[model samples]
Target: MELALPTEILEDSRNKGVVTALYDALSRRDAEAIQQILAPDLEWWFHGPPSHQFLMHLLTGSNKDSSSPEFSFVPHSIAAFGPTVLAEGFDPARSIAWVHAWTVTDGIITQVREYFNTSLTVTRFSAAAGQSDCSIATLHCPSVWESSLPGRVGKSVPGLVLAI
Candidate 1:
């Protein structure tokens, strides 16, 4: 069954499109495509284990100093809340999962905040924040989700925690 995004998210088409295109470019491992979507000076932040930070290089295909393994992330869900877009990406082969929140402005992706293997924990906050009834929802705020990945059951999905 296909899940539907909330109406509020649907209303913000431009940001949503930018988020979707960014993921699509990453999945294709198309550096040129990614560059087109990202801002010239993108601000990327990584949270969690130190190793997880390498994801920025992976996404941008810019690990020239070391040999980076090629991997694909399938986004299970995507939602746009205001200028930020939240997505859950999972690599079934490696049993790895992550939630990425992209901040888009003027058709360019300006910032990306990635949380590795911590979708469920952060999702709980979405419910409490009352952003939306959907599994994930975005809010127009600065606070981001912070949680550990453990005892998480079922498929790895991304959720948005809105502070509004």
Candidate 2:
């Protein structure tokens, strides 16, 4: 008769695969695959620097070519923080984003967050892609104000302000 492992062991094993897959997808710049693993109602919150803007700048190849600074995760350790999985890694060049993910219910990832030094990226790309600093991406988030406003206020904000 086959035997099943304990729940904790199974969960932990899955965590490793999930973390590895995330890194692989990101390095390959596979946005579709990245979105696929996340839950449909995913709450992806970002901190540190504006990666989206950075990506745009990078792809434009004015600041940096589409190719990112080659990075590979040197996993230091893995731990579960609340419902989130934290994979600590050391990137000698500090080029890649450090990811944190919170999964809830049926292996569905509910939230995801990433951190990285934008200044470094901007500098690196500027040198590599041979373009002057067009505009360094800022970290301010419009969502901060939106979130503070009353719920459903977003629906009203648009109608209230008619562009003349």
Candidate 3:
């Protein structure tokens, strides 16, 4: 008998695919495909050096004439937590590491938070038991993924690098 994957697994795969497709489009500089993947009112947040903001240039169609450094986010690993998908990549030759946090809603990316060079971490916050409001819950939030600072020395470590 054939077996079907669980709903959560299926959803995660689909979301991952969406994020992957977006990255593929980005690498190709496919503006049409990127437009199709991103929502009209996409919210973007970027942290790190302004000089390393290659992604912003890509999205806004700037730096077309300049021969700037390229940062292709080829995520070695991707994970999905509900609608949020996290992709991380590093370039040892260039001494660059990046993390892209994409929120996919109904198969379209509505938001993206980009981090580069420094470090990254993803923590999931759940209200403590008997704490009705998370806003008031001064308790500690669980750490989902803690990563080290990228671009340490030499080539990056194999696989995904998570730094807190």
Candidate 4:
């Protein structure tokens, strides 16, 4: 059965859809698709540990190493306020959670702010503009060490920060 979402939730869902589409494009290495979603002059800021910087390189195709492994982002929740879409990325394998704030204008993403391992702060400030800060949702996992498995070991630490 199709359950209808409220108008506000539907808008938030649409914004989240954009983010999901962007991630899907990146995962497929489809530059053309990414170009369609991002503004001509995109501004991004990432705050976290260094290991996560690969996201920038990946998006920009700066890392020429073909052997680099592919990574995925799993968003747990998404909310929208004005032109901003705030989503949470939960990486259970690394016991980490990141919040991404994407600002879209005319269906194009113009700016992005990523906060890794800072879900608490991100959620606190994700309330509607002019509204007092309110708590946001988070994803929970039982085990985050799966990424450390023998062959699955990743070079990047459990922490990460990337901006473009």
lDDT agreement with native, every candidate: 0.67, 0.45, 0.78, 0.64
Quick one: ranking by lDDT, best first? 3, 1, 4, 2
Q: Candidate 3 residues 28-88, lDDT tens each?
A: 9899999999999999988777888888887886877778666677887788877889887
Off by over 4 Å in 1: 1-11, 59-68, 120-151, 154-164
Clash numbers, per candidate: 0, 0, 5, 1
Worst 10 residues of 1 by lDDT: 119-128
Looking at model 4, residue 10 earns an lDDT score of 68
Off by over 4 Å in 4: 1-13, 66-68, 122-164
TM-score of each: 0.63, 0.46, 0.79, 0.62
Candidates 1 and 2 compared by TM-score, better number: 1
What is the per-residue lDDT of model 4 for residues 78-110, given as tens digits with 9 covering 90 to 100? 666656776676666766666777887767899
Of 3 and 4, the candidate ahead on TM-score is 3
Give the better candidate number (2 or 3) by lDDT.
3
Worst 10 residues of 4 by lDDT: 140-149
Instruction: Evaluate model 1: give its TM-score.
Output: 0.63
Clashing pairs in 1: none
